[model samples]
Target: MASKDSIEMDQELAKRLFTEGATVVLLDVPKGTDFGIDIKSWNTGENFKGIKMIPPGFHYVHYSAVDEFGDIAPRVGFIHWFSKSEFLVKRWDPKEEELSSEPVPEEIVQRLKDNLMNLDRYLGPYPYDTWKQWQELTNRIDSTIIERCAPVCGYIRSALELENCDDKSRPRGAETSRKRKRGACLSDEQKEQELLPDLKPKAGTELRLTELPNLHYPEGSTPAEITKHSLDSSYTLDLLLSKLKQPIEIIGELQLAYVCFLAGQSLDAFEHWKLLVSLICRADSAISVRRLIYIEFLRTLEAQLALIPEEVLYDIVASNNFVYHNLRRLFANIESNSEVDARLKSEAVRMRDRISTKFVWDFSNLQEEEDDEAPVVVSLDAE
Candidate 1:
């Protein structure tokens, strides 16, 4: 029967994957811990070890610890570039309730490998359904981009790690006076505790993302030029590109930020992703000059937008957020710029049409809207 043939084919594919794919050995994680790769997630069982048969390339591995009361800790994750048939071993630290910072010993890794067959039942197969989509989203990212942008601590956390601020870093003046008045009647021990420094995000936990150029106009620009640059951020885009070895790297960073936010749930990555989107969408002149970059940008943005959950999309579009505003500006610029390549302009139009149909946005009134906000020059005669 045809059904039997399909089952056999699937079985063969599974065997191939099991024989050729990489493996990750996670040791001693607690039951009910949340674990996931790419877009798939599940709570772990007592017998859970890690993932196996992972396709070779970039993948995100994330997890969150669950407490006795069923509360989940903030998510933490890392990106890994797997080689075919590679083996990676990691262990949990009960004290820290996280993956151990220290590397697994080579002897232990070898022992695990020697007994991998016995442990196979404890491992989960990589979720294959979304693998192709994940590949497309991360096609531009590589090891170099990961090393450049990932935090020094090697973990992307949904919540920033906080530490007590030193006296020098604590607020002074009015804030100090207000705190004093509030704590005036407290016991000495309580007052000492109140005076203790507030907690702040720990150093070294920040992603080393490329610095974005300032939005201000260049110093030597005339008034008219400043106004023009304000409307079209092509000059700022050029400055940002100049700092990179290649313009495409911007797309890589964009992909990295998006992945961190999507998989690790890091808000910092979300903000960086938004900023990058704003920069790209506002570069009106760059569409013509950097035709290839614009083409790739459109492709990347289209894929990312398609994957965004509807609820998130609602939040982004409902408030006329940065994405909606900048995309409108980008489309308008593409429509008016005669120098843009025909193919690029056609692509932009198609994207615009798709966005309009999907989001019920009206792009036809852009000209009228721009005219309404046009700057007025007042002329005054000296008396």
Candidate 2:
């Protein structure tokens, strides 16, 4: 009789075959390109065909085309949901620098399926090593969220395009907002707008979550206190929390977005991160809620900051101005009470100091009312 581990491995292999899985056959891809699905990466060789036994669901396929001189094209990727037993195929177009797919003749697909054993050497196996991470990243992305957040184009890929679309705020103009001035402070109206509910994100672009407005005030700030300040639905964290009845759903979405962003290089994930930051910062959630979740948020942010490549990190910080701005705002409100709060505050301060010391960018002057157009560079002479 086989040992327990051997028996388990054999059982797993047999179960994988019986359970529905998908196959991808990529043809004519450049020999030196790096291709990946989910968390598994493969360097293409002469006989490279595709990946096999893909567990059927959503997966991100990405590639970096390389040239003889070691130059790399901007990485491009797409997300696809493979049906059970799906046999998808694609052919690479060198001129277009993209993969193109069409309906494969049934006979050809049948032949490939029958000869899978012969082609096994060319097909890479599903990466069990990275499956757990991928699962954690994707498990919370339910069908409803997927349907809501998917770009209108019916295909998911990375490329920023400017088109004639209605201005979200004005609804009448075709203007795309430009970068802010060096020292711009948001007006009272602008500050309030941040708390307004953003129910539907624009279509034909990367998917992003809506920032549900906060409606609840802390115990001390009653209706009269809020009314005196002319606080509208915009400052209603209670309302936002009510809308998000299942807070775990939101947290899971954040984790999924972050993991996809870091591991799969999904630009869509970056957009999602921005949405999450906007929600958390502007919601002005109760102190208890903030205390409970701030550490997790801080830890996640630190992990991302530590792991991201320097070049990419700079680009992200520069392009996504809300990143540090919102983080600073989040940290500013932590009233430093219990031991947990103190520890979280320490971590937050450490992160701020690290960025200031290493990057010469100071978060000390970050104001909640100001739009962070760019980092404040501190000169050595000024110190």
Candidate 3:
């Protein structure tokens, strides 16, 4: 019944879809169920079949399987990278109320292909509204990082499986106990546990952030070097400045970790944050550098705090002591008026007060203020 040109255009569209677009066929997903691919959602009806014309890249598929009784299962999600013309399929199990691994037979795939025109009516296009936001969130994460951090199981779930609810509250395991019983000598694992406030091991479905190694000093560094740069003093300032100059790619990893934890509820992101704060706060550089670094640190923290979601702010405040303490130290350092540069002093005061007013936190100290002009800032080149 169609005109010749109309039929040719349809054929061309089909060819394009087959060559470039990815397909996700959800078998037996119930009518009226909530389903989402990437950032878009739909309440699927009986007419719904699946999604077509999805771009080739990493995507999140989330669904809340509904039952006839109206009870809803926990929302589940996973990350998958689609290839060109990929035909991926998943089947929903009514009994389990979850997706099962039952493979779609080859014959069924062929049948679907043959009926592609008819099925096209039921397939929805990918969501574009949130795609821009998703790009901003993932821009820094490269293929290497993705390959390193992704779960071996190929997907992540929103909720982790908790074990031994009646016993120890720690969901990670009894490894900490065994470590303590063994001895007080700290290995990397032990050090990491100490640093993290909520050091629980990730369970089912949770996206894990890439693990970052502990900070180490350069080779052949002396004891005096260690003593000179004790974490509490000015040496810490130098460390912060050096780290601030790190490449954008590495910085992107931190941003990726942050956004993932914020948006994806990844525990791995939480861990990464702990390390980042520790590195920034534990440096003990000299006085001049310390003053400069405090300004930089204040700017960085304020930016991060402003951008962080309100829901996650409480977790951040409660989890870490380093940032808070260091901030207070910065405020105290400014109040001391140790430096001769009046402009630097004024800006430091302004930064401290601005954060204090915004967060409603008293960053001031109870200890007596250091004398104004305690000493002149020494030259960096001076011996």
Candidate 4:
């Protein structure tokens, strides 16, 4: 049995090895330590860390078992000890043996024997007959000791995971809950089909030309008479709020948010809609149809808030990460996001800084505010 240090060395080497069977090592070079390539990993146990991709023993190296003298570390002139005992080199050439020579020295013979032991005993090409024994042996040291496994998990594989029923697990009694609410589902769908927002706003909802006395939605429409046009009964505020509580389709919730925005109920709509999203997502970050819809909703809100006036951007900023990272990007998209016109954003930043500073002292709830009322109207003209 190997001593503690030898076992430790094996463990250390296994930890540093990459999936592709590559390892970084410093080799003895004439100039300095040179990086070696094709250093294969003999341990095939599974590891969650290090390089990905399994490797074979046939990979290139500077030296074979029983031969050591070579231009392995010309760069550093010594192996950069990545782990215990194991060494790596890209280029290897054995020292020339004399044609006429005396018997091998005891020290020289011992060194060759040690090298042979390292190869044949530790990491050698074994026969199929001993495959099970080898597997059992490696299993004692590590888990991912297989010779052919790949590491590949990113947005790409994560996207394709939808086919594997990863998203279909149902909560206990979910079928019963759906059955109980069956009648409500049809009405919700019907409502969505009827009031789906027309792709584009047509001659927008009438407003008091004076109340919004500055810019108009259309690029060139100038401000006209100041008469107040009470919002049409067809677009009741109550209906908009009701729609938010039940997002039959993403469009309805989005429309509700927009109308609330236009009606100067920015905070009410922001909280209602955002809370609906939070409820849909809850604590689960897994992908689902609901999560996809929520993501789309976030994208839409981000695009619209970009048009908010620079001077009043403070109202949109929030201490919540979900609110801030996404919502701030919405504002940041505007041409007015620059330091020249983003005094409100600057103020928001200061507020956030203060919030982080204060967190050290208090560990209570950290929402910006709980009230649904829109606190301060940005006087766009004041700027």
| Top of the candidates by lDDT | 1
lDDT winner between candidates 1 and 3: 1
- Compute the lDDT for candidate 4: 0.30
RMSD to native, candidate 3 = 10.9
- Residues 62-114, model 3: lDDT tens digits: 77777788776556655666788788777788887767757778888878877
Q: Which candidate would rank higher by lDDT, 2 or 4?
A: 2
Ten contiguous residues with the weakest lDDT in model 2: 173-182
> What overall lDDT, based on C-alpha atoms, would model 3 receive against the true structure?
0.60
User: Candidate 1: worst 10 consecutive residues by lDDT?
Assistant: 170-179
Q: Considering every candidate listed, which one attains the maximal TM-score?
A: 1
TM-score of each: 0.85, 0.58, 0.55, 0.20
Q: Distance (Å) between predicted and true CA of 75, model 3?
A: 3.2
Model 2 residue runs over 4 Å out of place are 1-20, 67-69, 83-85, 105-107, 164-205, 208-249, 252-256, 263-268, 281-383
Model 3 poorest ten-residue lDDT run: 366-375
Off by over 4 Å in 1: 1-12, 163-200, 370-383
RMSD of every candidate to native, in Å, equals 6.3, 9.9, 10.9, 25.4
Candidate 4 similarity to native, TM-score: 0.20
